[model samples]
Structures are given as structure tokens and as C-alpha cells.
Target: MKIELLAPTSAALPTLVVAAGERASVRFLEFFASAIRNPHTRRAYARAAGDFLAWCAGAGASSITAVQPLHVASWVELQTQTHSAPTVKQRLAAIRHLFDWLVTGQIVPHNPAASVRGPSHTTNKGKTPVLDATEARQLLDSIDVSTPIGLRDRALIALMVFSFARIGAALAMRGEDVYVQQRRLWVRLREKGGKTHAMPCHHTLEAYLHAYLEGTGIADDPRGPLFRTVARGTGQLSDTPLPQANAYAMVRRRAFVAGIGTKIGNHTFRATGITAYLKNGGTLENAAAMANHASTRTTQLYDRRRDEISLDEVERILV
Candidate 1:
């Protein structure tokens, strides 16, 4: 039995009226608000908690009090087998936090997830996949820039490779983010954790962007999306902005057409950009700042130094 509560626009707040049977439950709404800071994180945690609650209902543990450590351990085991280590860890953490709130609120005698351990982090090394410069060039060359859609794809690929943008940030970009001063192109990007970073556009990227803009007839609207869907069927530019999923699909399609049998995605361009920059004598700190990583350790994962070892230099040592 569920009840819905509605609040008037002029009212300061909604009223909560719990029935006699549901009196012993924890304040789920309050707990949810306090547990989550960001909307994205809140959604993820809510989904995880929903899954656990559904499992608990099926297992005949309808209330938080009926939950036990064995149930949590079994759930963790199921998640470990089905999902990646990081995902399992996140879900487990969410469950642990939920039960902690219940215990603190005195709704439950003990926290079931307290004794449960998440998936092991045995292979915690970051093994990000990336494309080499040759493959990247091949991808760019594969696109025919004579057509509007092709020119757009070329510019998008160039931005991804040169700017090292996450697919979300790239898709979120608006036309006004690009600024031209003294014939030099620059882009202002809003990155993760709500941080903004400015980057100069490379000459190759600038040329591609100019061609794309000219071919697409994009307006100078700062509020409009930078990348839009090219209406190949109608021979016009789409008003809608490209979503993150579309960006991934575009990369995959390009990789297929280029005949580059690599698992290339948006992150591939970022990893490739960072690795290429480091190989060309760029410092880890610069890469970290560009990548919007909080720590050098995160950026170092993309810097594959082992591939840079020179066998000729080692063999030619006279000492």
C-alpha cells in the first residue's frame, strides 16, 4: 500500500503522515537527501539501493530490520560475478551507506553490510586503450571532407584527439566556447567536477573546424550546441545537439570504415592524446591538468612509458 503526497505552490513544504504499520521504518527521504551531493551520484546510488530493495522483497525480507549479513554477502557475490570490480564496489558502498543510516536512525539493530566485503581490487592498474598517431591519421584520412557530414565527422574527431575531451564534455560544448583571436582558435571547456579549462586549438584542428563550420552553416549562437546532427537525408544541419552515445557510435563507425581493428571510443582519443603528448616530451603535470585529473597518478596511467624504451640505445651503450 503506497500513498502519494502533494504540496501546494505557495506552501513552504509538504506534510508527512506515516500510517501505524509503517511507523518503525527509517526516514528514507531525509536519508537520500543527506547521502547524495550530486544529482548523478544520487541517481546511481538510488538505482543501486532499488536493486537491493527488490532483492530483499523477493527474499521475504520486506523491511530493513529483517536484513542480515548473509543476504548482503550473497548480493555482493552475485554483483561481483555479473559486473566489473569498480561497479560492484560502488554498489556495495551504496548498500553499506544505506544500512549505516538505518542503524544510526535506530530503525535497524545492526548494519548487515558492515561485515560484507566488496569485490577485490587485485587488478587495480589502469590499462586504458589508445590509438597511435599513425592509426589516428588513418582515421582522419578515411573521412571524405567534400560532404557536409564527412567534414563534421572530421572536425569532431580532430577535437577529440587534440583537445582530449571526454565524450560528455565534447557533447556539452556550445558554439560560443570557440573563440578566434589573431587567427588562432581557442576553446573553453567545462570539465568534470564542474571545473573549466581553456585550451588552444591546434592548426590541424583549426582548419578542420573552419571547414566544418563553413560547410554546415552553423550560426554564431553562443547558446547553441557546437556539434549538431547533420541531416544527410535532408542535406541540412540538425538543430539538436549530439548526445554522448551518438559520439561513441560515430567513433565506432569511423573505426570500422577506417579498417582500424581497435576498440576505439571517445576515451581512446583522450588516452591517445595524453600518451602522444607525453611521448613528444610533455610533462605529466601538464597532461594531468589538461585531462582534469585531480592527481598525477591518474594521469600517469595513460602515460605508457614502457612502449618508449629504445632497444638500439640500450644496445649501443659503451659502458
Candidate 2:
């Protein structure tokens, strides 16, 4: 879906519709859209543009030509009070690109936000919480497998922990994505950033999945949702896929059932899976590849660096 931001043009200036039949504006929009195909990126850009235009209104700048570096700097400062430095920087980048479009289209003299500076922040702080092995076991044991919904939830948790899939990817998955080959179940994941990944299902997951499929009687239709909500009244599973918020709620519910007082969420599984793999002698390179991270640095943050597996220690120094 295309989002439009309309800023009133000055009466003294020619009424130029930025996104209407303008070759440069069209090209710029196409390039920006292509660079960011993810829905999150689109939402971020829409918000940033809204803030910039609102600022423009307050500053008495009706047209793109009236914007100045000071106005851009002021907006950055205002955003920094509520958002992180990286977020502020992202907003600045969006504004810069918008002005560049204006400049290229001859709607503005130059890009005023070109030299606008963004706030700085620490890059090494770990934010995602991870579950230990005990916690993982407790979460699984908390579910009542006697019920069909409980069985389905157990299978979903197993997939998240084993495959390290993002909640969105898990919810977006369809029945056809699961297939049996060579006596092993393979799950096809439609990952973020438009990438496809395959993860091997362990025996435990395979058993749980089999139970869920048979109990729910979910069709083998390739396009149907892999997981669905069984109607409360009729006890029939609906084909609608679960939403991301629903996935988080499921995790929270499981955490409560397991007596885990800590704040566990969908991201916890991702970090826990990566940490468990590495602690079991998996290499950083392989972990990075599995996580689909472009750099090992991103994956390193997920590893528990405090618990070193080294055997070397001087007795005197240790004392």
C-alpha cells in the first residue's frame, strides 16, 4: 500500500504536486520503495515523514524549498528526547532522502538535511532476554497436551526454540511449508528481508507436529495456515493465521503457566536458541548462518560470553 504525505504549497510559489506525474519524484519513490520492501520499513518512513511535515507546518515552511538545516536539526533534537539515537538517525536519513528527491525534481534548491547530525548511542548493550535450558523445559511441561490447542501450542514453541524463527515468520508459515523427507521433517521458513530458509525438525518436534495435524484435522492444502485457532463454540479450526501479537500472548501465557516470573517473549526463544547452539560447541559462523545474520558481530551478541568454556586457568591467579 502506498502512503502519501501532503504539504501545502506556498501561494507565491507554483502549486507543484510532489507525487503527481513528476518523473524525478516517481523515480525517487520507486527507488526508496524498492530499497525497503519490509512493512516495518514502510511504517517507519511514513511516521518520519509525518513528523517532518508537522515540523514544517510549525516553522511556516509551506513548500519543500523553504526548509532549512536549522529546522531539520530542531526536529532531530525533538525526536531524540523520546526515541533512541539509532531511531533518530534513521529518521534523519529518511528526511535527507526526501529532500534529495525534492532537489532532484527542481522543487527545492538543495537538500537542507544533508549535513544534519544524529544522536549517538552505545552499540554493545544486549536487549533480548534468553531462556535457560531449565526454563525451556518448564515452558514445555506447563502445557496440557491432552487438549488439541495445548498440543498445537507445544508444537509451535518447539518450532520457535529449535528453528529460531521470528514470530512473524512463524505465523506467516503455511501447511505446505512442512514436509517429510528421508524420515525427517523439514520446515520451510519465509524469513524477513525476503529470504527463504529451511530448518530440520528434531524427533520431538516431529512427534508433536504429527499429533497436532492429526488431532486438528488441518488440511494438507499448501496455502492454508500451518497454525489456526479452533472455534470456541464449534471446536473447528479456522484457517486464519495467528497474528504477531497473538504469538507473543501465547508465549506470555506459557511463561505464567511454567511459573517463570521473568518477562519472557517471542525474542527470548531466538536468543535462547542461538545461545544453546553455541554452548553445545557450535561455531559462530554456523550460528550466524542459521540466524540469517549478515555479520557474525550480530550473532555474537546472542552468545553468552560470560560463561567461557575454556579449561585454562592458573591456580594462583584463580585463588
Candidate 3:
């Protein structure tokens, strides 16, 4: 019965929540279903909320309403011992937000996580590994473009490197997202927070995209996904959108074949492009705009120009 109610939300009602009553169970399910818009965030928050509630149940909390500040605080402290500060902080946020939703629904009298504090952390740089210009070029050139799959892979990588696009946004794109503007090729990305970002293609990226679209004949189905899975046993593109995990695996396989040693992921190309742009005299403000970052501070995290300086200075030690 609870599973039926939670089917749409994909979150199970915690033991404590189920014990609270049908109203609490329904409200608990609604919190995740209606309160969160992003599927990834919703999943993360649901996991956090479930883990915390299960902990409370084991700690002798009789019901959902029995959770207290001490329970929230203890769980947060335990998280810090096993998790990084940022991850702990995100879990704490999940607990706090879930309780807030429950309180608004009158399921809980107050939010137990309201007074809890998360660990503090700060960083100036992102940890996504980046490839140098030569390596980037080599990887792209190493791909054999005679096949449709090869053309798709090459175009996808070039899109991230040249447009500074997030993998989520790039994968969300439809065939119609690649369109002409002012006699130039342009790509549309639906970024986080529902922001739509459009960027004109670099000449190299333009050529790659043209080849992928025409070679695969995906251009005819403007409503279908731009990037698709290869049909099983057919060696042809399927209508299904390519999942992010598949994209990551494709990148790793491509890197291995190209003899590149860097442990890279989908995000590597975005940071690499930003660093390359900065090295080529692109301003931080302009990079922020092109990358659709709300602030230059966020953009600066991807700028790795100082890494070269640090390496050069380390050589001076002569150790």
C-alpha cells in the first residue's frame, strides 16, 4: 500500500514515517514528489532523508514526530566522521529541507534539523581533471569518423570542449537544439535551474556537428534526442537518449585507446575548455558568460592557469 503511494516519487516511506499514520505517509511522499524539481537532487535528498529516519528508528524514536534535534545532530556528526564536509553538508541540507516540508504539511510540529550545524569547507578550485590542448586535439583526431558511432562520439566531445557545456545540459538537447543563427551553427543547452543557454559553434565544432547530424541522419527527426544509444545488435542509432553513465564509459574507453593517461570524466572537457580559453586570452567574465555561470568566482574554479605556475615554481626547489 505504501509502495503504491510512493511509486511516483520513487522513495519508500521510512519505518518511522509509516508508523506515524496515513497522513504523515502521504505527506512524506508528497514532499519528494512535489517539492523537488531536479531528479538527481530528489534522489539524493530522498536517500538522505531515509537514512536519517532509519537511524532515528534504531535510536528508539517511536514515530516520525519523535525525532529530535539530538538525533539530527548525532547523525550529522556521524556523517562527518565517514564523509567529506561537502557531502555531509548536503545530507544535512536534505534533512533540514525534508523537515521543513513536513512542518508545512502539519505532519511535524517543528523541523528537528533546524538547529543542527554542518561542517565548514571551502575551495577555490574544482577537482575535475583537465586535458591540455594537444591532448584534447589528439583524442578528437584519434577517433575514426567513418562510422556513425564515431561521428557521434567526436561531435559530443567537441561540443563539451568547444561550448563549455555541462553533460546534463548537452545530453538533454534534442535534434532541434542544433540550429542555425545568423549564418552560424548554434547549440542550445538547458542548464541547471531551467536556464536555457545558447552558444554559437566554433568552426571546428561546426564541422563535427554537421558530420554527425548528416552522417547519422538524425537531423530528419528534430524532435528526437540529439545523442542516442546504439540499437542492440544493429550497430545503428536508437531513439533512446544516451545515458550519462554510457557517455562516461565512452570517454574512458576513448582516452585509453588514444594512450592518454589522465583519469577523466564527462566534466573534464568543460574545465579543459575553460582553461584553454583562459590561456588563449579569454577574460574570466567572458568565460563565465559563455559557460553560463552566474558569477566569475564559479568560473575561476575551472581556470587552471595557476597549475602551470605552481609546477614551474616547484622545479625551482631543485630537490
Candidate 4:
């Protein structure tokens, strides 16, 4: 019962009629437009809400106002059968928060999801595939820096691994974000929640950055995007900023060429960097600070030092 956007002009701005009558959908639309600030969160919540409301409509609920705690519980229970615990919990949170927004806006009597409990989930480890120290070094050294694209690729990957930068923050940088502070290169990241995080570049990262910047000749264009798309037919970077999808594709290609076959994504470097740091006697608090995490618990997920111990123990069980 997924609702398809009636208007095709812009997929994101689709008119979704959630309630029974068209009139009750105003608050539903406004909830996403005004209440949600993060685009990723907004998109996810909208999908969850849309899916739930469509289900409710099929379940004979009259309108948004008629949605009850029973309906929320029923949907949540259904989700548990097909989705992972974390995903179920996230979807439930989306519903609960949306209803809360509607309640405060006077669109509904009360939140239907207020008492609903999501599935239980807890983990000390994250799922991001990380490279070992040797593998990480091999991957970095494998990149040939003969072309502008090659230089850019090596630098971008090094930045993430050395500085523990999130992909979004790394791509969002302007050329000016890389600057000389106290005669050493430093990077400024506009991280999640719009927090400005600044970290001194690792000496290796500094070398890669200098190579990319100087080789590209875009260093003087301080206001231009730090990472640019390779222009079609020119074998050089275009003025347009590199998109996240393109970055992912480049990473996959590089990994494949390097003959390393662990299914990795952008977050792989961040986890690899943190694990490397912690293995060298770095503290959890310092790792949290470097990774711009609000809590050490989140930082702990990236610490894969325990992974080595687990591997060593597994060798004892001879088949």
C-alpha cells in the first residue's frame, strides 16, 4: 500500500494524501517541511510514515485522527518479521515522532505511537567493513597518482583514513576549508548537526592533500569545491562538485583494481582509521573527540581492536 507521488515534476515534493479526507493531510505534509531538519532523516521518516498510513488506510482506519495505539503496535509487530531489529526500531521511531509532531500541531488528538514499543536492539560493534592496517596501507599505496583523477582519488581516501572523516563531511569541503594553521595543514569539517569540527591533518594526509591541491591547480580557487567531478572528454576535473554516488563508484573501482575484495563503503575508512588509532594506545575519549562523536559509546562501535583477539581465538578451534 505504498503511496506513489501523484505529481511527477519533482519526486521529493510529491503530494501524499495520508488521511481519509484530503483536508487532514496538511499537518502531515507540514510535519516533514518544518519539523525535520536533516534531509536523510526527513526522507526516511516520510517513507516510514507513508508506508504506515497506507497500511492503516487498508486496515479500515477512517482517518489520521482514527489511528490508535493498537494500529501502531500491529504494524511494528508486522515489521519485526521482515526487517532487522534496528530498522524496525527506526521505522517505529519515525512513526512515533511524526505522530508527536502532529499532536503538538493540533492535527490529532494525541500520539497513537506514544505507548508502542519497538523491537530490542543493542550492539558494541558496527557493520561498516574495515580494512586491516596492512590492507589499508596496501590500498593507499596501490593508487597511481599519475593523473588528476588519480591524485584526487588517493587524497580523498587518505583524508578519510587518516583523519577519520565521514564521507558527507569530506565531500562538503570548500578549498578554503584546507588551510595552514600554526604552519601545519588543518581541515575543517562541517559535520552532522552543522557542527564545525577542525582537525590537524595527519602528516601523511598533509602530503596527499598538497599533491592533490597543487597538481589540480585548484588550490588558488579557495571558494571552489574541494572535490570536483572529472569533466567528460577532458580528462580533468569539472567545476561541479562530486556527488556521493560517484564517490562510492570510484571507491569500488579502486578496491577492485587493488585486488582487495571486502565489500566496503565510504564509512570503511572511518572505522579503519579509528581501529588503527585505538590499536596504537589512543583513548576512547580522544577517538570520540577526533571522530566528532557526542558519546564514547558511538566511538566504541568503530573500535575493532577486539576483532584481532576474536580472530586469534578462532584459530585455536582446529577443524
TM-scores of the candidates in the order shown: 0.80, 0.83, 0.95, 0.94
Sort the candidates on lDDT, descending order: 3, 4, 1, 2
Deviating ranges (above 4 Å) for candidate 4: 1-23
Greater lDDT among 1 and 4 belongs to: 4
TM-score of 3: 0.95
How much RMSD separates candidate 2 from the native structure? 5.0
Report how far off residue 203 is in candidate 4 (Å). 0.4
Counted clashes in each candidate structure: 0, 0, 0, 0
RMSD of each: 6.0, 5.0, 2.0, 2.8
Candidate 2 lDDT by residue in tens digits, 1-319: 1353242233212222242335544544553455567778777875786678667767777555577899899889999999988889999988887777667666678889998888877665267777877788888888988876788789888888788777778878888888888779888888887799887786777888788777776645668898877776875667778777887898898899889987988888877888888888989899888877889998888886443333234333664
lDDT (C-alpha, whole model) for all candidates: 0.76, 0.75, 0.93, 0.88
TM-score of 2: 0.83
For candidate 3, give the lDDT.
0.93
- Scored by lDDT, the top model is 3
Kindly report which residue stretches of model 2 are placed more than 4 angstroms away from their true locations once superposed: 1-35, 104-106, 305-319
* Regions of candidate 3 where Cα sits further than 4 Å from its true position: 1-11
